[model samples]
Target: MPPSLPFLLDRTDLHLAELHAARLDGDLVGVGDRFSPADIAGTVDLRGARELRALSLLPRLPVGLVVERRTAAWLHGAWAAPPGPLELCVRSDHRVRVVPDVAWSVRQAVLRPDELILVRGVLSTTPLRTALDLLRLPPDDRYDGRHRSAVITLLLMQTSGRERAAAALHRSPHLPHKQRALDRLAALSLR
Candidate 1:
Protein backbone atom coordinates (compact mmCIF):
# COMPACT_ATOMS: atom_id res chain seq x y z
CA MET A 1 0.00 0.00 0.00
CA PRO A 2 1.06 3.56 -0.62
CA PRO A 3 2.26 5.46 2.41
CA SER A 4 -0.42 7.63 4.02
CA LEU A 5 -0.16 11.38 3.62
CA PRO A 6 0.96 13.39 6.61
CA PHE A 7 -1.85 15.01 8.54
CA LEU A 8 -2.12 18.72 7.96
CA LEU A 9 -4.58 20.10 10.46
CA ASP A 10 -7.25 22.48 9.27
CA ARG A 11 -10.29 23.80 11.15
CA THR A 12 -12.16 20.62 10.56
CA ASP A 13 -9.36 18.58 12.05
CA LEU A 14 -10.21 19.77 15.53
CA HIS A 15 -13.41 19.56 17.50
CA LEU A 16 -15.07 22.97 17.97
CA ALA A 17 -14.14 23.47 21.61
CA GLU A 18 -10.52 22.47 21.04
CA LEU A 19 -10.27 24.80 18.05
CA HIS A 20 -11.66 27.70 20.05
CA ALA A 21 -9.33 27.03 22.99
CA ALA A 22 -6.31 26.75 20.68
CA ARG A 23 -7.20 30.07 19.07
CA LEU A 24 -7.98 31.75 22.38
CA ASP A 25 -4.57 30.75 23.70
CA GLY A 26 -2.73 31.94 20.56
CA ASP A 27 -1.61 28.44 19.77
CA LEU A 28 -3.35 28.53 16.39
CA VAL A 29 -2.38 31.53 14.34
CA GLY A 30 -4.20 31.27 11.00
CA VAL A 31 -7.81 30.88 9.98
CA GLY A 32 -7.42 27.67 8.09
CA ASP A 33 -5.33 25.46 10.23
CA ARG A 34 -3.60 25.20 13.58
CA PHE A 35 -0.11 25.20 12.11
CA SER A 36 2.84 24.54 14.35
CA PRO A 37 5.93 26.73 14.14
CA ALA A 38 7.80 24.05 12.22
CA ASP A 39 5.08 23.77 9.59
CA ILE A 40 5.24 27.52 9.19
CA ALA A 41 8.97 27.24 8.50
CA GLY A 42 9.14 24.29 6.19
CA THR A 43 12.36 22.91 4.73
CA VAL A 44 11.73 25.09 1.66
CA ASP A 45 14.56 27.56 1.03
CA LEU A 46 13.43 30.85 2.54
CA ARG A 47 15.05 32.98 -0.17
CA GLY A 48 13.09 31.59 -3.09
CA ALA A 49 9.74 32.76 -4.41
CA ARG A 50 8.51 29.18 -4.63
CA GLU A 51 8.86 28.80 -0.90
CA LEU A 52 6.95 32.01 -0.28
CA ARG A 53 4.23 30.95 -2.66
CA ALA A 54 3.95 27.58 -1.00
CA LEU A 55 3.79 29.06 2.47
CA SER A 56 1.22 31.67 1.54
CA LEU A 57 -0.94 29.13 -0.24
CA LEU A 58 -0.79 26.08 2.00
CA PRO A 59 -2.99 27.76 4.55
CA ARG A 60 -5.40 29.58 2.26
CA LEU A 61 -6.24 27.40 -0.70
CA PRO A 62 -9.81 26.21 -0.53
CA VAL A 63 -10.59 22.55 -0.86
CA GLY A 64 -10.80 21.40 -4.51
CA LEU A 65 -9.65 24.70 -5.99
CA VAL A 66 -6.87 24.61 -8.60
CA VAL A 67 -4.51 27.52 -9.07
CA GLU A 68 -4.36 29.13 -12.52
CA ARG A 69 -3.61 32.33 -14.49
CA ARG A 70 -0.73 34.49 -13.28
CA THR A 71 -0.73 32.71 -9.95
CA ALA A 72 0.10 29.46 -11.69
CA ALA A 73 2.84 31.17 -13.69
CA TRP A 74 4.27 32.57 -10.49
CA LEU A 75 4.24 29.11 -8.96
CA HIS A 76 5.90 27.68 -12.08
CA GLY A 77 8.76 30.24 -11.99
CA ALA A 78 7.44 32.54 -14.69
CA TRP A 79 7.03 35.55 -12.43
CA ALA A 80 8.92 36.83 -9.41
CA ALA A 81 6.19 38.76 -7.61
CA PRO A 82 4.59 37.46 -4.46
CA PRO A 83 1.14 35.98 -5.08
CA GLY A 84 -1.74 38.35 -4.47
CA PRO A 85 -5.35 37.27 -4.07
CA LEU A 86 -5.63 33.60 -4.83
CA GLU A 87 -6.72 32.88 -8.41
CA LEU A 88 -8.28 29.54 -9.00
CA CYS A 89 -10.14 27.39 -11.49
CA VAL A 90 -12.96 25.11 -10.59
CA ARG A 91 -15.30 22.90 -12.54
CA SER A 92 -18.75 24.28 -13.28
CA ASP A 93 -20.21 21.96 -10.71
CA HIS A 94 -18.20 23.24 -7.75
CA ARG A 95 -19.34 26.00 -5.43
CA VAL A 96 -16.85 28.45 -3.93
CA ARG A 97 -17.82 31.05 -1.39
CA VAL A 98 -16.20 34.45 -1.03
CA VAL A 99 -13.29 34.56 1.39
CA PRO A 100 -12.49 37.66 3.46
CA ASP A 101 -8.99 39.20 3.42
CA VAL A 102 -7.77 36.67 0.90
CA ALA A 103 -9.57 38.25 -2.11
CA TRP A 104 -9.92 35.11 -4.18
CA SER A 105 -11.13 35.01 -7.77
CA VAL A 106 -12.33 32.00 -9.71
CA ARG A 107 -12.88 31.09 -13.30
CA GLN A 108 -15.14 28.30 -14.37
CA ALA A 109 -13.81 26.19 -17.22
CA VAL A 110 -13.97 22.77 -18.77
CA LEU A 111 -10.81 21.16 -17.46
CA ARG A 112 -9.24 18.28 -19.25
CA PRO A 113 -7.84 15.70 -16.88
CA ASP A 114 -4.30 16.43 -18.09
CA GLU A 115 -4.29 20.23 -17.78
CA LEU A 116 -3.39 20.23 -14.08
CA ILE A 117 -0.20 19.41 -12.22
CA LEU A 118 1.06 19.55 -8.66
CA VAL A 119 3.44 22.22 -7.41
CA ARG A 120 4.59 22.01 -3.79
CA GLY A 121 1.58 19.78 -3.09
CA VAL A 122 -0.87 22.29 -4.55
CA LEU A 123 -2.78 21.55 -7.73
CA SER A 124 -2.04 24.09 -10.45
CA THR A 125 -2.20 24.54 -14.17
CA THR A 126 0.83 23.16 -16.02
CA PRO A 127 3.48 25.59 -17.22
CA LEU A 128 2.37 25.23 -20.83
CA ARG A 129 -1.24 25.72 -19.86
CA THR A 130 -0.33 28.73 -17.76
CA ALA A 131 1.57 30.19 -20.72
CA LEU A 132 -1.38 29.60 -22.95
CA ASP A 133 -3.68 31.18 -20.36
CA LEU A 134 -1.45 34.23 -20.15
CA LEU A 135 -1.40 34.58 -23.90
CA ARG A 136 -5.17 34.53 -24.00
CA LEU A 137 -5.41 37.63 -21.88
CA PRO A 138 -6.19 40.83 -23.79
CA PRO A 139 -3.08 42.83 -24.58
CA ASP A 140 -3.80 45.36 -21.88
CA ASP A 141 -4.24 42.60 -19.31
CA ARG A 142 -1.00 40.82 -20.14
CA TYR A 143 2.40 41.79 -18.81
CA ASP A 144 5.00 43.71 -20.83
CA GLY A 145 6.97 42.03 -23.61
CA ARG A 146 10.13 41.74 -21.55
CA HIS A 147 8.38 39.97 -18.70
CA ARG A 148 6.42 37.79 -21.07
CA SER A 149 9.64 36.81 -22.71
CA ALA A 150 11.07 35.80 -19.37
CA VAL A 151 7.95 33.83 -18.59
CA ILE A 152 8.16 32.06 -21.93
CA THR A 153 11.82 31.25 -21.42
CA LEU A 154 11.32 29.91 -17.92
CA LEU A 155 8.23 27.88 -18.80
CA LEU A 156 9.90 26.49 -21.90
CA MET A 157 12.90 25.49 -19.83
CA GLN A 158 10.64 23.82 -17.29
CA THR A 159 8.83 21.84 -19.98
CA SER A 160 11.96 20.88 -22.00
CA GLY A 161 11.75 23.67 -24.56
CA ARG A 162 9.62 24.59 -27.58
CA GLU A 163 8.33 21.25 -28.78
CA ARG A 164 5.98 20.68 -25.87
CA ALA A 165 4.68 24.24 -25.94
CA ALA A 166 4.08 23.93 -29.66
CA ALA A 167 2.31 20.64 -29.14
CA ALA A 168 0.02 22.09 -26.46
CA LEU A 169 -0.98 24.95 -28.70
CA HIS A 170 -1.59 22.63 -31.63
CA ARG A 171 -3.66 20.26 -29.58
CA SER A 172 -6.12 23.04 -28.82
CA PRO A 173 -6.16 24.91 -32.11
CA HIS A 174 -9.89 25.35 -32.00
CA LEU A 175 -9.63 27.56 -28.93
CA PRO A 176 -10.26 31.22 -29.74
CA HIS A 177 -7.03 32.09 -28.01
CA LYS A 178 -4.76 29.80 -30.01
CA GLN A 179 -3.58 32.57 -32.31
CA ARG A 180 -2.72 34.73 -29.34
CA ALA A 181 -0.54 31.96 -27.93
CA LEU A 182 1.08 31.56 -31.34
CA ASP A 183 1.78 35.27 -31.55
CA ARG A 184 3.34 35.33 -28.10
CA LEU A 185 5.49 32.30 -28.85
CA ALA A 186 6.59 33.81 -32.16
CA ALA A 187 7.49 37.08 -30.48
CA LEU A 188 9.52 35.24 -27.84
CA SER A 189 11.38 33.27 -30.53
CA LEU A 190 12.35 36.45 -32.35
CA ARG A 191 13.78 38.02 -29.20
Candidate 2:
Protein backbone atom coordinates (compact mmCIF):
# COMPACT_ATOMS: atom_id res chain seq x y z
CA MET A 1 0.00 0.00 0.00
CA PRO A 2 1.10 3.56 -0.60
CA PRO A 3 2.43 5.47 2.37
CA SER A 4 -0.25 7.31 4.26
CA LEU A 5 -0.44 11.04 3.64
CA PRO A 6 -0.11 13.58 6.41
CA PHE A 7 -3.23 15.36 7.65
CA LEU A 8 -2.59 18.57 5.70
CA LEU A 9 0.29 17.57 3.48
CA ASP A 10 0.22 18.71 -0.14
CA ARG A 11 3.74 18.87 -1.38
CA THR A 12 5.58 18.41 -4.68
CA ASP A 13 6.27 14.78 -3.94
CA LEU A 14 2.58 13.89 -3.66
CA HIS A 15 1.26 11.77 -6.51
CA LEU A 16 -1.93 12.27 -8.47
CA ALA A 17 -2.96 8.66 -7.98
CA GLU A 18 -2.58 9.01 -4.22
CA LEU A 19 -4.68 12.16 -4.13
CA HIS A 20 -7.33 10.51 -6.27
CA ALA A 21 -7.41 7.48 -4.06
CA ALA A 22 -7.73 9.64 -0.94
CA ARG A 23 -10.56 11.55 -2.54
CA LEU A 24 -12.28 8.31 -3.52
CA ASP A 25 -11.98 7.06 0.03
CA GLY A 26 -13.62 10.27 1.29
CA ASP A 27 -10.63 11.02 3.44
CA LEU A 28 -9.53 14.14 1.60
CA VAL A 29 -11.04 16.99 -0.37
CA GLY A 30 -9.41 19.11 -3.01
CA VAL A 31 -8.39 22.67 -2.15
CA GLY A 32 -6.88 24.40 -5.11
CA ASP A 33 -4.37 21.75 -6.25
CA ARG A 34 -3.92 20.31 -2.78
CA PHE A 35 -5.77 17.75 -0.74
CA SER A 36 -6.95 18.50 2.82
CA PRO A 37 -8.74 16.42 5.36
CA ALA A 38 -12.43 16.29 4.47
CA ASP A 39 -13.68 16.40 8.04
CA ILE A 40 -11.92 19.60 9.08
CA ALA A 41 -13.77 21.79 6.59
CA GLY A 42 -17.24 21.92 8.12
CA THR A 43 -16.58 20.55 11.55
CA VAL A 44 -15.90 22.51 14.71
CA ASP A 45 -12.34 22.78 13.51
CA LEU A 46 -13.19 25.43 10.96
CA ARG A 47 -13.25 28.76 12.74
CA GLY A 48 -14.14 31.76 10.67
CA ALA A 49 -11.81 32.74 7.83
CA ARG A 50 -8.56 31.51 9.38
CA GLU A 51 -8.83 27.80 8.90
CA LEU A 52 -6.12 25.97 10.85
CA ARG A 53 -4.89 24.62 7.56
CA ALA A 54 -4.16 28.07 6.19
CA LEU A 55 -1.26 28.41 8.64
CA SER A 56 0.59 25.87 6.56
CA LEU A 57 -0.27 27.40 3.18
CA LEU A 58 2.50 29.98 3.17
CA PRO A 59 5.25 27.49 3.87
CA ARG A 60 3.91 25.11 1.27
CA LEU A 61 4.01 27.67 -1.53
CA PRO A 62 6.89 27.29 -3.96
CA VAL A 63 10.09 28.85 -2.68
CA GLY A 64 11.42 32.21 -3.96
CA LEU A 65 8.04 33.30 -5.31
CA VAL A 66 6.40 36.42 -3.92
CA VAL A 67 2.70 35.71 -3.52
CA GLU A 68 0.34 38.59 -4.14
CA ARG A 69 -3.15 39.80 -5.17
CA ARG A 70 -5.98 37.44 -4.30
CA THR A 71 -3.53 34.74 -3.29
CA ALA A 72 -1.93 37.03 -0.72
CA ALA A 73 -5.32 38.16 0.50
CA TRP A 74 -6.41 34.58 0.95
CA LEU A 75 -3.23 33.90 2.87
CA HIS A 76 -4.05 36.84 5.12
CA GLY A 77 -7.35 35.29 6.25
CA ALA A 78 -9.63 36.53 3.46
CA TRP A 79 -10.96 32.96 3.11
CA ALA A 80 -12.66 33.82 -0.16
CA ALA A 81 -11.61 31.14 -2.56
CA PRO A 82 -8.49 32.42 -4.32
CA PRO A 83 -7.85 32.14 -8.05
CA GLY A 84 -7.11 28.64 -9.37
CA PRO A 85 -3.80 29.87 -10.72
CA LEU A 86 -1.53 30.91 -7.89
CA GLU A 87 -1.02 34.66 -8.22
CA LEU A 88 2.74 35.18 -8.12
CA CYS A 89 4.92 38.26 -8.41
CA VAL A 90 8.60 38.07 -9.20
CA ARG A 91 11.12 40.84 -8.82
CA SER A 92 11.42 43.10 -11.83
CA ASP A 93 14.98 41.86 -12.30
CA HIS A 94 14.29 38.13 -11.88
CA ARG A 95 12.94 35.78 -14.52
CA VAL A 96 10.95 32.60 -13.96
CA ARG A 97 8.95 30.28 -16.14
CA VAL A 98 6.06 28.76 -14.20
CA VAL A 99 3.75 26.09 -15.61
CA PRO A 100 1.11 25.57 -12.96
CA ASP A 101 -1.80 23.36 -13.97
CA VAL A 102 -4.18 26.23 -14.74
CA ALA A 103 -1.29 28.58 -15.50
CA TRP A 104 -0.02 30.98 -12.81
CA SER A 105 -0.80 34.68 -12.96
CA VAL A 106 2.76 35.92 -12.90
CA ARG A 107 3.95 39.48 -13.05
CA GLN A 108 7.11 41.49 -12.50
CA ALA A 109 6.80 44.17 -9.85
CA VAL A 110 9.33 46.02 -7.73
CA LEU A 111 7.72 45.80 -4.31
CA ARG A 112 8.87 48.26 -1.69
CA PRO A 113 10.59 46.87 1.37
CA ASP A 114 7.67 47.87 3.59
CA GLU A 115 5.17 46.09 1.34
CA LEU A 116 6.43 42.57 1.87
CA ILE A 117 6.58 40.17 4.79
CA LEU A 118 7.99 36.69 5.31
CA VAL A 119 5.54 34.15 6.62
CA ARG A 120 6.87 30.70 7.31
CA GLY A 121 9.72 31.20 4.86
CA VAL A 122 7.41 32.22 1.97
CA LEU A 123 7.34 35.87 0.94
CA SER A 124 4.10 37.73 0.21
CA THR A 125 2.71 41.22 0.01
CA THR A 126 1.53 42.91 3.16
CA PRO A 127 -2.21 42.88 3.78
CA LEU A 128 -2.46 46.57 2.95
CA ARG A 129 -0.54 46.14 -0.30
CA THR A 130 -2.69 43.19 -1.23
CA ALA A 131 -5.79 45.27 -0.54
CA LEU A 132 -4.47 48.03 -2.75
CA ASP A 133 -3.65 45.61 -5.56
CA LEU A 134 -7.12 44.08 -5.45
CA LEU A 135 -8.78 47.47 -5.28
CA ARG A 136 -7.01 48.54 -8.44
CA LEU A 137 -7.00 45.18 -10.17
CA PRO A 138 -8.27 45.12 -13.73
CA PRO A 139 -11.18 42.75 -14.14
CA ASP A 140 -10.20 39.25 -15.16
CA ASP A 141 -12.17 36.31 -16.55
CA ARG A 142 -10.86 34.09 -13.77
CA TYR A 143 -12.82 35.82 -11.01
CA ASP A 144 -16.55 36.38 -11.06
CA GLY A 145 -18.44 39.28 -9.50
CA ARG A 146 -19.49 37.38 -6.38
CA HIS A 147 -15.98 36.22 -5.69
CA ARG A 148 -14.62 39.73 -5.98
CA SER A 149 -17.37 41.13 -3.81
CA ALA A 150 -16.75 38.52 -1.16
CA VAL A 151 -13.03 39.15 -1.20
CA ILE A 152 -13.58 42.88 -0.88
CA THR A 153 -15.95 42.43 2.00
CA LEU A 154 -13.48 40.26 3.83
CA LEU A 155 -10.73 42.79 3.22
CA LEU A 156 -12.74 45.56 4.76
CA MET A 157 -13.22 43.40 7.82
CA GLN A 158 -9.51 43.53 8.60
CA THR A 159 -8.26 45.82 11.34
CA SER A 160 -8.39 49.45 10.18
CA GLY A 161 -8.56 48.22 6.61
CA ARG A 162 -10.89 50.93 5.39
CA GLU A 163 -8.93 53.74 7.03
CA ARG A 164 -5.56 52.42 5.91
CA ALA A 165 -6.63 51.90 2.32
CA ALA A 166 -8.06 55.39 2.15
CA ALA A 167 -4.91 56.95 3.57
CA ALA A 168 -2.72 54.98 1.18
CA LEU A 169 -4.96 55.88 -1.74
CA HIS A 170 -4.37 59.58 -1.24
CA ARG A 171 -0.60 59.05 -1.09
CA SER A 172 -0.52 57.79 -4.70
CA PRO A 173 -2.32 60.11 -7.07
CA HIS A 174 -1.37 58.39 -10.31
CA LEU A 175 -3.07 55.08 -9.68
CA PRO A 176 -5.77 54.07 -12.11
CA HIS A 177 -9.36 53.74 -10.87
CA LYS A 178 -8.65 56.14 -8.00
CA GLN A 179 -12.06 57.76 -8.15
CA ARG A 180 -13.80 54.44 -8.53
CA ALA A 181 -12.02 53.04 -5.49
CA LEU A 182 -12.88 56.13 -3.48
CA ASP A 183 -16.53 55.73 -4.39
CA ARG A 184 -16.38 52.06 -3.54
CA LEU A 185 -14.86 52.77 -0.13
CA ALA A 186 -17.50 55.44 0.49
CA ALA A 187 -20.28 53.06 -0.39
CA LEU A 188 -18.76 50.30 1.71
CA SER A 189 -18.46 52.66 4.67
CA LEU A 190 -22.19 53.24 4.61
CA ARG A 191 -23.05 49.56 4.90
Candidate 3:
Protein backbone atom coordinates (compact mmCIF):
# COMPACT_ATOMS: atom_id res chain seq x y z
CA MET A 1 0.00 0.00 0.00
CA PRO A 2 1.12 3.58 -0.59
CA PRO A 3 2.42 5.34 2.52
CA SER A 4 -0.35 7.37 4.05
CA LEU A 5 -0.09 11.11 3.77
CA PRO A 6 0.33 12.89 7.09
CA PHE A 7 -2.36 15.10 8.62
CA LEU A 8 -1.84 18.81 7.94
CA LEU A 9 -2.92 21.74 10.10
CA ASP A 10 -3.50 25.43 9.47
CA ARG A 11 -0.80 27.10 11.57
CA THR A 12 -0.39 30.55 10.07
CA ASP A 13 -1.13 33.16 12.74
CA LEU A 14 -3.31 35.40 10.60
CA HIS A 15 -5.38 32.51 9.28
CA LEU A 16 -5.59 30.25 12.29
CA ALA A 17 -8.73 31.73 13.74
CA GLU A 18 -10.26 32.12 10.34
CA LEU A 19 -9.45 28.56 9.37
CA HIS A 20 -11.00 27.36 12.61
CA ALA A 21 -14.07 29.41 11.87
CA ALA A 22 -14.30 28.05 8.34
CA ARG A 23 -14.04 24.54 9.65
CA LEU A 24 -16.93 25.26 12.00
CA ASP A 25 -18.87 26.77 9.13
CA GLY A 26 -18.13 23.78 6.88
CA ASP A 27 -16.65 26.11 4.32
CA LEU A 28 -13.15 24.65 4.47
CA VAL A 29 -12.48 21.70 2.17
CA GLY A 30 -9.50 19.39 2.05
CA VAL A 31 -8.27 15.94 2.79
CA GLY A 32 -9.51 16.76 6.23
CA ASP A 33 -8.04 13.58 7.65
CA ARG A 34 -4.58 14.50 6.29
CA PHE A 35 -4.10 18.03 7.54
CA SER A 36 -0.60 18.65 8.88
CA PRO A 37 0.51 21.56 11.08
CA ALA A 38 2.76 22.87 8.32
CA ASP A 39 -0.18 23.18 5.92
CA ILE A 40 -2.25 25.11 8.45
CA ALA A 41 0.58 27.45 9.45
CA GLY A 42 1.62 28.22 5.89
CA THR A 43 -1.60 30.06 5.08
CA VAL A 44 -1.88 33.85 5.43
CA ASP A 45 -5.57 34.12 6.35
CA LEU A 46 -8.79 32.16 6.72
CA ARG A 47 -9.66 32.68 3.07
CA GLY A 48 -6.29 31.28 2.11
CA ALA A 49 -6.96 28.27 4.27
CA ARG A 50 -10.31 27.84 2.61
CA GLU A 51 -8.67 28.03 -0.76
CA LEU A 52 -6.01 25.55 0.27
CA ARG A 53 -8.59 23.19 1.62
CA ALA A 54 -10.51 23.45 -1.64
CA LEU A 55 -7.34 22.75 -3.60
CA SER A 56 -6.49 19.81 -1.39
CA LEU A 57 -9.92 18.33 -1.87
CA LEU A 58 -9.39 18.16 -5.58
CA PRO A 59 -7.93 14.97 -7.02
CA ARG A 60 -4.37 15.26 -5.74
CA LEU A 61 -2.53 16.47 -8.77
CA PRO A 62 0.84 18.20 -8.69
CA VAL A 63 0.17 21.90 -9.20
CA GLY A 64 2.99 24.42 -9.09
CA LEU A 65 2.59 27.68 -7.24
CA VAL A 66 2.00 30.73 -9.45
CA VAL A 67 4.61 33.53 -9.21
CA GLU A 68 5.36 36.98 -10.63
CA ARG A 69 8.35 39.00 -11.93
CA ARG A 70 10.41 39.37 -8.72
CA THR A 71 9.73 35.82 -7.63
CA ALA A 72 10.56 34.56 -11.09
CA ALA A 73 13.84 36.45 -10.99
CA TRP A 74 14.71 34.81 -7.70
CA LEU A 75 13.85 31.37 -9.09
CA HIS A 76 15.75 31.95 -12.34
CA GLY A 77 19.07 32.96 -10.65
CA ALA A 78 18.88 36.69 -11.44
CA TRP A 79 18.32 37.21 -7.69
CA ALA A 80 18.74 35.03 -4.66
CA ALA A 81 15.70 33.57 -2.98
CA PRO A 82 14.92 35.16 0.36
CA PRO A 83 15.53 33.17 3.51
CA GLY A 84 11.90 33.12 4.57
CA PRO A 85 8.83 31.82 2.79
CA LEU A 86 8.26 33.38 -0.62
CA GLU A 87 5.30 35.57 -1.50
CA LEU A 88 2.99 35.23 -4.50
CA CYS A 89 0.77 37.71 -6.34
CA VAL A 90 -2.95 37.05 -6.31
CA ARG A 91 -5.72 39.09 -7.95
CA SER A 92 -8.45 40.82 -5.99
CA ASP A 93 -10.77 43.77 -6.63
CA HIS A 94 -9.23 44.48 -10.04
CA ARG A 95 -5.79 44.65 -8.49
CA VAL A 96 -2.91 42.40 -7.53
CA ARG A 97 -1.93 41.73 -3.96
CA VAL A 98 1.42 40.36 -2.83
CA VAL A 99 0.65 38.24 0.19
CA PRO A 100 3.48 37.12 2.41
CA ASP A 101 3.47 33.47 3.42
CA VAL A 102 3.08 34.17 7.12
CA ALA A 103 1.20 37.43 7.41
CA TRP A 104 -1.64 39.48 5.95
CA SER A 105 0.67 42.14 4.54
CA VAL A 106 -0.08 42.89 0.88
CA ARG A 107 0.91 45.42 -1.79
CA GLN A 108 -1.62 46.34 -4.45
CA ALA A 109 -0.98 46.41 -8.20
CA VAL A 110 -2.89 46.42 -11.46
CA LEU A 111 -2.08 42.77 -12.18
CA ARG A 112 -4.09 39.60 -12.49
CA PRO A 113 -3.56 35.84 -12.31
CA ASP A 114 -4.12 35.41 -16.04
CA GLU A 115 -0.74 37.07 -16.49
CA LEU A 116 1.14 34.18 -14.86
CA ILE A 117 1.95 30.53 -15.53
CA LEU A 118 3.98 27.69 -14.02
CA VAL A 119 7.36 26.83 -15.50
CA ARG A 120 9.73 24.17 -14.21
CA GLY A 121 8.31 24.15 -10.69
CA VAL A 122 8.36 27.93 -10.38
CA LEU A 123 5.37 30.15 -10.96
CA SER A 124 6.44 32.66 -13.57
CA THR A 125 4.61 35.55 -15.08
CA THR A 126 3.62 35.03 -18.72
CA PRO A 127 6.26 36.21 -21.15
CA LEU A 128 4.25 39.20 -22.27
CA ARG A 129 3.45 40.08 -18.68
CA THR A 130 7.04 39.58 -17.63
CA ALA A 131 8.22 41.85 -20.37
CA LEU A 132 5.61 44.44 -19.50
CA ASP A 133 6.41 44.28 -15.80
CA LEU A 134 10.11 44.50 -16.54
CA LEU A 135 9.54 47.53 -18.71
CA ARG A 136 7.88 49.27 -15.77
CA LEU A 137 10.89 48.65 -13.55
CA PRO A 138 13.95 50.88 -13.44
CA PRO A 139 17.18 49.83 -15.13
CA ASP A 140 18.24 48.06 -11.95
CA ASP A 141 15.44 45.49 -12.38
CA ARG A 142 16.23 44.52 -15.93
CA TYR A 143 17.38 41.00 -16.73
CA ASP A 144 20.43 40.21 -18.81
CA GLY A 145 20.03 39.16 -22.43
CA ARG A 146 20.38 35.48 -21.57
CA HIS A 147 17.50 35.58 -19.10
CA ARG A 148 15.36 37.73 -21.34
CA SER A 149 15.88 35.39 -24.27
CA ALA A 150 15.12 32.41 -22.11
CA VAL A 151 11.92 33.98 -20.88
CA ILE A 152 10.82 34.72 -24.42
CA THR A 153 11.68 31.25 -25.65
CA LEU A 154 9.76 29.57 -22.85
CA LEU A 155 6.76 31.81 -23.38
CA LEU A 156 6.66 31.15 -27.10
CA MET A 157 6.84 27.43 -26.48
CA GLN A 158 4.10 27.49 -23.85
CA THR A 159 1.47 29.86 -25.29
CA SER A 160 -0.27 30.54 -28.57
CA GLY A 161 0.53 34.24 -28.73
CA ARG A 162 1.87 35.01 -32.20
CA GLU A 163 -0.54 37.94 -32.42
CA ARG A 164 -1.15 38.73 -28.78
CA ALA A 165 2.56 38.99 -28.16
CA ALA A 166 2.88 41.53 -30.92
CA ALA A 167 -0.10 43.52 -29.68
CA ALA A 168 1.16 43.50 -26.11
CA LEU A 169 4.48 44.92 -27.22
CA HIS A 170 2.79 47.58 -29.30
CA ARG A 171 0.62 48.73 -26.39
CA SER A 172 3.21 48.50 -23.62
CA PRO A 173 3.54 51.69 -21.61
CA HIS A 174 7.04 50.89 -20.43
CA LEU A 175 9.31 49.15 -22.92
CA PRO A 176 9.71 50.77 -26.30
CA HIS A 177 12.44 48.24 -27.08
CA LYS A 178 9.73 45.58 -26.95
CA GLN A 179 8.83 46.17 -30.59
CA ARG A 180 12.20 44.80 -31.65
CA ALA A 181 11.81 41.85 -29.33
CA LEU A 182 8.33 41.20 -30.67
CA ASP A 183 9.57 41.29 -34.27
CA ARG A 184 12.33 38.86 -33.41
CA LEU A 185 9.92 36.52 -31.64
CA ALA A 186 7.54 36.61 -34.60
CA ALA A 187 10.36 35.83 -37.04
CA LEU A 188 11.55 32.94 -34.93
CA SER A 189 8.05 31.49 -34.80
CA LEU A 190 7.79 31.48 -38.57
CA ARG A 191 11.03 29.51 -38.99
Which one wins on lDDT?
2
Query: Between which residue pairs do clashes occur in model 2?
Result: none
Ranking, lDDT, top scorer first: 2, 1, 3
Which portions of model 3 show Cα errors greater than 4 Å?
2-66, 70-107, 112-127, 159-163, 172-191
- What's the residue-level lDDT of 59 in candidate 3? 28
List the candidates' TM-scores in order. Answer: 0.64, 0.67, 0.38
Q: Deviation in angstroms for 78 in model 1?
A: 2.0
Error of 2 at 162 (Å): 0.8
Q: Give the clashing pairs for model 1.
A: none
**Cα miss at 103, model 2 (Å)?**
2.3
lDDT of each: 0.63, 0.65, 0.45
Give stretches of model 1 more than 4 Å off: 1-52, 92-102
lDDT of 1: 0.63
26-54: candidate 3 lDDT, tens digit per residue: 65433332243443435536434433433
Candidate 3 or 2, higher lDDT: 2
- Give the number of the best model, judged by TM-score: 2
lDDT of 2 by residue, 33-63 (tens): 5666777644633232244434446554655
Ranking of predictions according to TM-score: 2, 1, 3
Ten contiguous residues minimizing lDDT sum, candidate 2: 44-53
